[model samples]
Target: MEEKIIAHMTAEALYDFTLYHTYSKFAGFLTNVLGLAVGFMGIILVVTGKSPAVSLVFYLLASAAFLCFTPVQLKLRAKKQVQLNPEFKGETEYTFDEEGITSLHDGKELSYSWGQMKKVVATPKTIGFYYEADRALIIPKMDFKDRFVPIMKLAVEHTVPGCVKVR
Candidate 1:
């Protein structure tokens, strides 16, 4: 397997993350919880059989909050990767080596040592490391050749055996 690295994120990656992580997981949970809360409010509205205004207000507030969170979360996340690796202007060839991982930024190369990582994760989607939050270098999982996961996972595991194979 060819040694791989994180390049600039593709549109496909952003779309996949928004679709799977944002909608399926986050929205799903939010909707379920809000559904229950709304149902109870609806029941209260009917039982009281008065003040349709109360029900309307509750629904509007909940809906507004939900709408606000989605874009805000996406923006904050987008801000982070851009800031953490200021040199990552997209599509830069990130080189991973024994000393550190270096990538070109503003025509200069910067390296991040393995010591900075809390741990490395080999997922079906990317080679990610959790430095603080969900910061990871997502690569096309499909780009991997045979046993790519095993080899990548092996290298990190050899260096930091504590890395779990969540892939």
Candidate 2:
């Protein structure tokens, strides 16, 4: 049986998905952990009066820099998505079957065999099909009328090794 999905990509949805994907990676996790460690050490130094002012300043600067960087980068990427794919502003239709998936966007159609899909990355609100490490086709979860998660899972199983679902 073929499953059909029709959805529109919004900037907000894309932004959320990008942020989720970014922080779910090892690098992002490490950055956050290091930031917290630095912050705690700063606090400890202040309490102990060992270079208190310097430690506090360094902690604040480092924490703020790391925290603000991701959001800003995500915002820029979201904006670029809008600018680059004016076609995606409208509804995108996807048809999935045993063999592969076909997508129709802004009057243009493209088909991809199951084997062509390298990976499936799923989040609570979206599922992204990565053809390459840096390129993906993102679909919002809310776009499906029914059986959203199961359908995606089945698709991933059919096409790729496994789906990586991020919390």
Candidate 3:
């Protein structure tokens, strides 16, 4: 069995991953949900002829902008990060075994033990190995082709107990 996979990273993929990584968290999800709710409530009030105040409308617009524009901002940021960093543009190879993972890209190699990961999160389109609350090593599902399932299983098996979440 092949224990290695190679992925060609792209700006679009990076942006999508950034959006998912940010919004998949409990806090970020809740904040966006709240913004949506507030915006909808304002709309409902205006439609029902029970509009509160102009200040409330402004507040609602602000919330609506937060809900709508954050992803746009993140896209711009992700694009900039990918464009400015030479390490993210090419094919990165990840080799894994029972012990850990080694990634090689742009003539640089990095190794991380399974125990070094803070958590592993498996979503439908990506698997993320987080080293910190806000930092992760993402494996895009498409990059793995038909091997995503086995790779996910391997990650779950190797990561520490109670640190893997499948969503």
Q: Pick the candidate with the highest TM-score.
A: 2
**lDDT, candidate 3, 43-95, per-residue tens:** 77777778866756776887878797878888898788778887677788988
lDDT (tens digit, per residue) of candidate 2 on 104-160:
988889887777777777776778877667667788878977967556656756775
lDDT against true structure, model 1? 0.55
The lDDT of model 2 is 0.78
| Reference-based lDDT, residue 80, model 3 | 89
Per-residue lDDT of 63-122 in model 1, one digit per residue for the tens? 566556665666666566555645434555555555545656468775666666665655
Error of 3 at 112 (Å): 0.5
Local accuracy by lDDT, each model: 0.55, 0.78, 0.78
Q: Best to worst by TM-score, what's the order?
A: 2, 3, 1
Reference-based lDDT, residue 57, model 2: 85
TM-score of 1: 0.54
After superposition, candidate 3 runs with Cα above 4 Å error:
40-60
- Who is ahead in TM-score, 2 or 3? 2
